[model samples]
Target: MARHLRAFLGADDATLARRLTAAGTVQAVLDAIRTRLSEPARDALVAELTAATGGLLEEDLDSILLSGLLGYHGLVDAARQTAAEQDMTNLVTLDHHLVRVTSEPVVEVLVDRQQAYELRLALTVTFTVQGLAATVRAGRLVHVRIGRCSADVSLSWAGQALVRHSDLVDAPLVIKLGSGVPVHEITDPADDPALARGTARVPGPRVAQPGS
Candidate 1:
């Protein structure tokens, strides 16, 4: 389920909603069956679930969330860049801890050759990273690591049904850290001098830029 979700991260609004619904449906059935089984029987199904997901059920939650966050950032950067070139407003915010990101995309579409209306869309992805840790340098957060993660996703399109999920449900999942995974760099020291010194370790969550 995590593997499919990772692919859906970069998909269009409609496609994402469709896939999430499908995955959620499958997960519901699997969950019902597992709950009725004995403890040992339930435990044995772990291997089956792993096989069914091609091992993605056991994949690192940190890596999946990081990829999604990075992709989210890239989208925001692209949108802002385009807005700057076109002299338009781009309303996008990623929180300081990088745990939540919201984007409001406003585009003008012509109803005919003579009239047009602005179409506004919204998307938000929020994550709660359990046991999150941080590295601070020069008064700025520079790196992070995670123990586990759960997510909330919502996407809305003008004149269309809204899609939201507290977590992906295709199968019962336990999101945890992968062995030997390294801390992720959230900021580059070379990009900002303030991020280069005064190193300290701390605990926290992550994502955002000022005036953006």
Candidate 2:
């Protein structure tokens, strides 16, 4: 499952393995996914949304909100699919200490493949669920109320990934939702209209980011 997700996000397994204890693991993961995008894919995505909405949101704020909605859905879907593919019979307990990931992903298979990574099954893959909205400036924002989220997750696992999270090539124009952001913001790192069209930047990791 980890391998497939890395493939989906275009993350290099070797790099991830090496960074298992590094501070920049999350940033590195996001960059890997972000840098993979091509300009053309970004353009088409926005065009499709524009057509779907009958050009209702021609304004930048509206456009970004639309993008956030699309991006949020894509994130949730991919997370769910990835969660489903894993075999987690051995995931005995889901205590935080057993599965800590300050940045890098730790795929500690230990000597017990049968019981190792046992928490995968019991742990639900969650994202923002409701009370969600978006804001636009230089990029985008999927806003969550202070101390709250659409996913409504408890304080324990917010912002940090249960495992690994990364960006991809030919990906959407997303900005990092950096620490203390209080929302799932997918910003356009660069203000390129072409980014609006990258429909490939969705569930299952942006159409596999080219060499998926």
TM-score of 1: 0.34
Best by TM-score: 1
- Residues 117-172, candidate 1: write the lDDT tens digits: 23344555667655544332322223444445557755455434345556643232
How far is 130's C-alpha from truth in model 1 (Å)?
A: 1.1
TM-scores for all predictions: 0.34, 0.18
- Give each model's whole-structure lDDT: 0.38, 0.27
Residue range with the least summed lDDT across 10 consecutive positions in model 2: 93-102
What tens digits encode model 2's per-residue C-alpha lDDT throughout 19-131? 33243433332343453434563333223322322111122322233334444443344334434554311111111111111111121111111211211111111232222
Candidate 2 stretches greater than 4 Å from native = 1-70, 73-107, 111-122, 146-212
- Candidate 2's TM-score: 0.18
